[model samples]
Target: MPNWVDGHPAESLSIKDRGLAYGDGLFETIAVRAGRPPLLEYHMARLAEGCQRLGIPLDLQLMRTELLAFSAGLGEGVAKLMITRGEGLRGYAPPPVALPRRILQSSPFPVYPQVNGVEGVQLFPCVTRLAEQPLLAGLKHLNRLEQVLARNEWQGSEFAEGLMRDQSGRVIEGVFSNLFIVHEGALITADLSRCGVAGVMRAALLDSARAQGLKVEVRDIPFEDFLQADEVFLCNSLFGVWPVRSVTGHHWPVGPLTRKLQAIARDLLDI
Candidate 1:
């Protein structure tokens, strides 16, 4: 049982909601620590940017207050805030005047795996490839059938995360996280300009690494190139950074670079 709305009853979700019908909405999963989200501003910025791109009227002040108040006093948790085009009249056409609908829920932080969010994690290269949609590229939208299919490929018991490719078979990223590999002391990640979610942690690392004078490249990644990398790690808003111990039976070391990155990540988390 959780608060679906800030002050509304549970039945607030209409059967006619577009988000439920066509997944015409967006969501942000925030990591909370000590009654506060670590990167609240960055999360909000990504949310606002998604809303603006989707033509959804976003009451930034209202959203900020509702979610913040709801998340307060929860030392460790996850907050998912979503907005959908409310109650459309059975069609793809935008409503003359859209009434936005929302869902906000908080849950105790998930007990990530023993190796996950800790020592390191394994990855399974998924057969499911994300479709090319420039309009939706880099936005964390509600349409996640791709991720659903990818996640179902193999239970994370054998592998911590699934690696997804783009339509052209270019290594895109992990199903629910951003991908980064350290090669010759330089960090390389996929160029999300075409597809994949532009993760907040990914953005921060890009900025932080640049500030630290580390070379960061946003380029297309081939499977062979990725497998041959010196070091690799995956990141999300919640799991700050998790080094890849292996990928599809190929062993990888939790290198010195990954440890250095993890040190910064520890400061960004509840630990």
Candidate 2:
């Protein structure tokens, strides 16, 4: 299927579009199944928050309509939705009145080894550290040079993902996923108040854990504490959850809690 720009099928974007010029936008990677996005509500909620935070005007109703139409055409795949501040002059100041641009692109779903979701995977420790930016924290903003750099630090299938940390060496997240650790029967994930993307799958898992009466903690997790976790797992909108087997010299078993939450995530993603 062709890409949609501002709700119509298209092939190219304007040269002056702010998203291209300055990374001035937000985006969501949604998983579509049977002509529908299973996590549409979660994706939209984050997009709404990002629009409000960036003062970018967005029509949620219209976006929803377009997304539904786009997903129907693609059927089973991944839908990438980008909302830009639209075309702008060559400068830092945004246009006095912003006209947000909506872009939708389709791609085939990723194919990972079945062992990743079953037997578990290893993580590579990335040298690139995330910068502290409270204003952009958790928004899934378009500026992702940090993630790009971290992702490139690795070479092959030996590591399924790279573990990213903040400037202070606080364990934050994965290259393209959220991290969660189970310790002494409580679920803990790093707080994104200062950095990191607040992934939709992470939100869904938190909600499901809470609903199931599991102890969940969204707080700052130190590297030492993370290494001490009984079980660790990574999650994203597309891949559901993957039990983390090891990182660096330390190691961890694919514990029962990881399996339980993995089951919840699989159910949520309908995979």
Candidate 3:
């Protein structure tokens, strides 16, 4: 239940921290269960890629040890690890000597209806479009205004998740989770090379789906295709997977493939 900033217990960040000033940081939301993080490698892989692209140095081994300790402390919860470029002066340019700051915090696992994963959930199509920034695509950086605004568009339990698209109306992903649709017995998900966070759960599912000999395709999904999908599901590290029952008026049954993958997720995530 302790929050650590650079290995020290700190509740507040420096006002000049680059993460606050310009959203110059990367974050990973890790699900800790039974004193361990199951999908940690996938999260670390993405974080490492993000740090490399942003020119931030990451000692993967060190971070792994820290995260394990953090997870053990919390026992069961979500661990958020934020790595920033540390404090900076007023400017757009990064400092020559990058003093990266690591902030680790934990929160209780979210409470949701048990039927969410069993039956399925309704999705609200959001109007807030994700900009096509190839440079920022697939990275879980600190900048999340797009998701914030999209999530703010709806309220209450009518929709458990919201579907977001690119400005061109290409179905991208969920406000938080990645989108996957079963089409003609194939598992299809958005191509995140242009925009959207390449979630750890998405990556893991892709591998698992392929290992099970399921057809998997990552490509641009049109709104019509998404609506016509045999079965739809949303996934993230925390929730594992949630089938989408409807979007607008279009409806889908919790299909065979969705259930198959849900079992895989439960095994992999131990949720």
Candidate 4:
């Protein structure tokens, strides 16, 4: 698969790009199926919000066109779209007139153990806590060192994901995915107004749960409260859903609600 920079095939980026210097940009990891992104609108919506918040002038229509063409050519794979605030001088202040650079890259779909999606998996407890940044809370920005550190907390196949919390110790999400819990028949997830990435699959599942008449709540979850959940699950765009069977010393069975939502996610990803 060829990499595209500003809509042309390229393998290199400018040395002074703001995205490399100050992480001044946003990105989207999309799952392409049969020449198209299944959740493109969701990804674009997030990108638009990120661009607006960061004051990056993005050509959404042109990006949509390029993404469609690139994904069509690749046929099947993960499409990574990165928009950076173009090259800058030796300072923190952004350019008075910004010219955003669009980079599109493709990689083969990831392969995970089949048991992970079926029998469920364990979650590693990460000591790395997410800082509360309301301004950049839900945006999939370029700064991801926190997640990098948290992901390295555990090694080996024993743990499929790591559970992350906010600085205040509120259960936030997974290292690379969103966290959801079923409690007393209510489907609850963390309030991303303070931190954590609002994953595309998480959004879709929330809507699906509501449509299926399940009670939904989006609020800050205490660590103790999260541990008492009837069932827990994690989700991301690349890998639909994985039922979290255990984290730390607590354990949860793959309940009916989790299985139902997992099926919904599988259908959404067409896996």
Query: 188, model 4: CA deviation in Å?
Result: 0.4
**Which residue pairs overlap in candidate 1's backbone?**
none
Q: For residue 236, what is the lDDT in candidate 2?
A: 98
The sequence of per-residue lDDT tens digits that candidate 1 reaches over residues 1-271 is: 3556534536367778899999988998988887788888888899899999999986888888877776774557897778887778878997989888778877778787757756688898899999999899999999999999999999638788988999888888899999999889989999988899999888877777888888889999987888889998998888788999887689778887777777677676655
Q: What is candidate 1's CA lDDT for residue 153?
A: 90
Error of 2 at 28 (Å): 0.3
> Per-residue lDDT for 169 in model 3?
98
Give the per-residue lDDT of model 4 (tens digit) for 21-47.
999999999999999999988998989
Count of backbone clashes, every candidate in sequence? 0, 0, 0, 0
RMSD of 1: 1.7
Q: How close is candidate 2 to the true structure, as a TM-score?
A: 0.99
* Ranking of candidates on lDDT, top first: 2, 4, 3, 1
Tell me the spans in candidate 4 whose CA falls farther than 4 Å from its real position. none
Q: Please, what is the whole-model Cα lDDT of each candidate in the order they appear? A: 0.83, 0.95, 0.92, 0.93
Candidate number achieving the greatest TM-score relative to the actual structure:
2
- The 10-residue segment with the lowest total lDDT in model 1: 1-10
On residues 100-145, what C-alpha lDDT tens digit does candidate 3 reach at each position? Answer: 9999998999888989999999999899999999999999999999
